[model samples]
Target chain A: MSESVNQQPVPLHEHGQRRPMKKRLWWIAISPSVWAIHFLACYITAAVWCEKIGEGNLRPLQISVGIYTAIALPVIIWVGYSSYRNFRRGDPPVPYDFDDPTDRTHFFGFTAFLLSSLSVVATLFTVLVFVLVGSCD
Target chain B: MNFVPSQSALDHAGVGAESIAGLFWVMLIGGCLIWLIVVGLAVYAIVVPGQHDQKRTRMLVIGGGAVFPTIVLTALLTYGLAMLPDLQRPAPEGSQVIEVAGVRWWWRIHYRMPDGNRVETANEIHLPVNEPVEFKLKSEDVIHAFWVPSLGGKVDMMPGRENRLKLHPTRVGVYRGVCAEYCGEAHTQMAFDVIVESREDYDEWLRQQASLAVAISDEAEAGRKIFAGSGCGACHSIRGTSADGVVGPDLTHFGSRRSIGASVLPNNADNLTRWIAETHRVKSGVEMPAFETLAEDELRALVRYLGELK
Candidate 1:
């Protein structure tokens, strides 16, 4: 099975050189736009919390809608295209070492922890601003 | 707005606000820092090649960080549960029981006093100051929320169900109450007032509400005929007459009541005219259909007759 497998390297992608390098560079530049999307996600989440606790106007549907459009979309494209680019570069495309089930579970748990932290820090900053500065009259 | 968090309500609110604000800040700060730490570990795990191989390193990251956080959450839950009883303190003797039914764009309030004499009104709720009162809440239609800031937390107003909340008024003031749910359009204007009065003032008011219907001019008799005839009796009820419509409040004492149109506006000749004519304009989402096209003379007579209910 090892002998039959195609190990020989191929071009990064069929259209690698066909498209202008500027466009590829532009896509690479556009990739960081995820941060803007994430910022919006964070801002909306904060708005939602304000509406819930501050005004009692927040609804679950509103939050879910905001997450998908403001948070999930940008993240999906960012991570997906980034991985694709690595494969296109022909540099050891797949790392089999990280495929262990335990590793995957750990990675997810680690991610959840970070997301929760973001929630905490964001809430703290919001409340501090309201308290110290008295944002609303 | 007698219900405005009285002195006791304010105290409840103050303490509640402090704890809420504290938890909010705690969640905010702690949550943010936790995110940073977890993200840092994840970034390291992903970028630092061969760092994934060391099981000890993995344990150090996951065990010390993620597992510990889970324990912290359990503790938070325990702490919250410990405070639940304080939220349900008992009402005092001779307390008022205000049954609040959340309706679209308004609130249907029924106050059943200790003597079994019941006073029902829409939108307007007046209570005595320094009294321990309980609210029996429900919704007539879709989901709604009962929320009065400067008092206590909120509870969902579910249909065909009842939820209760108790509060003690330590101050004499007016506070606003809002329907904190997204039931339909015009949700923004669905608001009410809690008018807390002094004990003596409340006793006098209750006595007035308990009296029989007031006398009206014989000329207003035409309006009474129209009220009973024009199918208004189908949706609204006048306790003294054959109008037993259950869709709306009992109008037996409408003429003597202090407010009108579910307390959206003061009960006056002109306001009553406008409400009867164009209720939807004043409150767009009001369940009652607009009667704006009614004739001028007929409107005057109808409003007068209704207002004569004492």
Candidate 2:
């Protein structure tokens, strides 16, 4: 049964469309990359503000961090939503344990969904630091 | 080993330390509970009668591994981060400001008196109970950290930059403070006594610290002469007799301090004598040189003279 499923490969769209390996991997990696970039942006902004700009008013830092978080969160949510759609596309739904292109696509989609969820939480945590700590001190 | 109560953060005597101790308890209990839950889940999976359906297994893997940890850690992070602003809050305006500079293996302390004069002291710090004091911390050479665990959190003292830490000590007792940063050789020996007393007692102590040293007895007077002549004044300052050298710790009220050699040894005649004769043996890499060339009688007179400063 598994061999038949593997051999009958015309790229099943009912489950998921088979894309190039690089594109699939990029889809898996994009959410975390966004999170990493957001983390760097927030921290570097804070460091430069604290060092170059005097520790007087934190309004600018707060505004900049807020903007970065606002931008990053929506992107993460969109990625998470798209991945969830891909994960739920198959007739069998999740537990994509079959040895076929459709199952492989679902597996990658599930992995991407998990990564996006993790990145969303991590980005929120990064923003939480600025919310609690008002000053460089 | 002899127990030091002030060395432990759990034995909190100040407002800041109280919050820290509370946080520690919460974290510890939370961690234990999480560990038990995780272990119990594993045990349940093994001890169950039959294989769980795919849905249940997926829930066990995803919910237990990811969701559970995410929720627990997020809550913990929020709880921990909320404590930072209060911990970093500056003292109120016109409050008592104490300037402390971390030197090699010692602490140079200055109490900013209301009369615009700074009362310089070393090693020991006296604070009035029930009052918040702001410490303007600096490092004269390398990086160091001032930590009085019983009182509050530690603050780093970096060279060329001043960091401030505010502590409101509630208990009136003797506490120990140490350099939390590993500065150099003898960093372990860099410690001081924090004497929290009543307002009256604190004022009296400060008054005495501000006054010039007086050699009342003949032995003390002889030692004073020896201290001045032996070039000890070049690094140490005793306000009365012109032994003013800013390189080392101020010795105006050296005898009144609870410990000698930055708390490396107890403040006693034997320890003092030994410290003077073999400075490096007590704490290596200290800037002060040994006075091994002094005669036995001269060393005793110097020790006696310094002991009477209190």
Candidate 3:
């Protein structure tokens, strides 16, 4: 079995870059990352505040959520706007051609834009949660 | 006669448990709808005969994948958040408070009387129906969790700090409670029974728990002598008698309880006999050693004595 496997020609896909280098793809991740960090900060703040100040007091948890929302919303909005601008700049001459540089770039930008939009909506939903829920039991 | 215990989240006997049940149904229905739609769309895309248009495909992906989940999740999140305060509502003005400390394999229970005296018991807790009862939980050893599936959710018992859970029983019945966290040996055998009764009945039971044991038979007296002579008093206690060991469960009213051996077995003659002879077979990690060296009649006498203390 080992001899036969070695003799077989390696698949062409194994020879080159598995995934293309697209630095701008990181843009799509910004909104979701903001949402995650904000969630962690909010949760830790609630737990520690409750432990220190007592579960009866809700002011600390409420204030922490307020601050988390205020800081997270603007950053996610900026990332979403940037992705939208890149997506709208132009379209490839012949769309859906991965071998063509311009087409690949266009595809990456559009995907980033789409993901950013979804993430922004998710971030907003999370902010609403922080605002609406106000207890630590 | 052994079967898996039914632990369903929908069976709510307390207000905390009721709110949890309501949340569960909402999530269940919503999740099923989402599952069906996603699967249906995928199936339709594969089976339907139609021209594939890029614009239509993009629109479908954006609408179904992004918009639908966002709307549904946002609504669920808001609803869940709105119920938080209700779930943690403060206990009623005169709610009774009880403290339960988790040990290696049992629960040390304490009821705070109005006269500032705390009545201590073990393994079993009795609560009055329709009354809010607050449980102040702690741990004497490693981390353990207190869970009565039919009554409410589980709460962790941390070693150094205190946590509180409030339960208001809506029904009169016996609920099985078990240690949800794995502390050490015999964790699976660390079970307790919560008896919910009417206020009058619960008060009478409480009064009985505060009193000493009553011995009325020669067999019991003979067994008591054996228990004292055999050094059982070093780790066991029968309040109102000479045996006052604090290392194990209090057996002052053990016979009257619904179950014995920390809910591992029903409190009956045969099971009690087997427990004294072969305790390891019944619960492997239990700290008690077998009394197989004792003669058959002596063991029977001891079992009868322990069985009739209630």
* Per-model root-mean-square deviation over C-alphas: 14.6, 3.9, 6.9
Compare the candidates by TM-score and give the number of the best one.
2
- Estimate, for each residue in B74-169, the C-alpha lDDT of model 3 and write its tens digit: 778788778776656657766788999998788888888888887777888999999989999999889999988777778999999899888888
DockQ of every predicted complex: 0.02, 0.68, 0.50
Candidate 3 — which residues are off by over 4 angstroms? A1-29, A54-57, A93-122, A125-129, B1-7
Candidate 2 lDDT tens digits, B1-310: 1234278899888999999999899899878877887898899889997968878888988788778878888888899899998888888888889999999889999999898999999999989999999999999999999999999999999999999999999998888999999999999999998989899999898888888886569999899889988999999988887888999998888888878888888899999999999999988998899999999999999999889877
- Candidate with more favorable, higher DockQ: 1 or 2: 2
Record all residue pairs in model 3 with backbone atoms less than 3 Å apart, i.e. clashing. Answer: none
Best by DockQ: 2
DockQ score of the complex predicted as candidate 2: 0.68
When sorted by lDDT, best at the front, the candidate numbers are 2, 3, 1
Model 1 docking grade:
incorrect
| lDDT of each residue in A1-137, candidate 2, tens digit only | 46665456534463345341213757888899999999999999999999899688998999999999999999998888888877666455557766666777678778888899999999999999998888887
Q: What share of the true interface contacts does each candidate keep?
A: 0.00, 0.76, 0.82
Q: What DockQ would candidate 1 receive versus the native complex? A: 0.02
Residue-wise C-alpha lDDT for candidate 1, range A64-128, written one tens digit per residue: 44454445444535444443443334333234235333232233333333444444333333332
Most accurate candidate by lDDT:
2
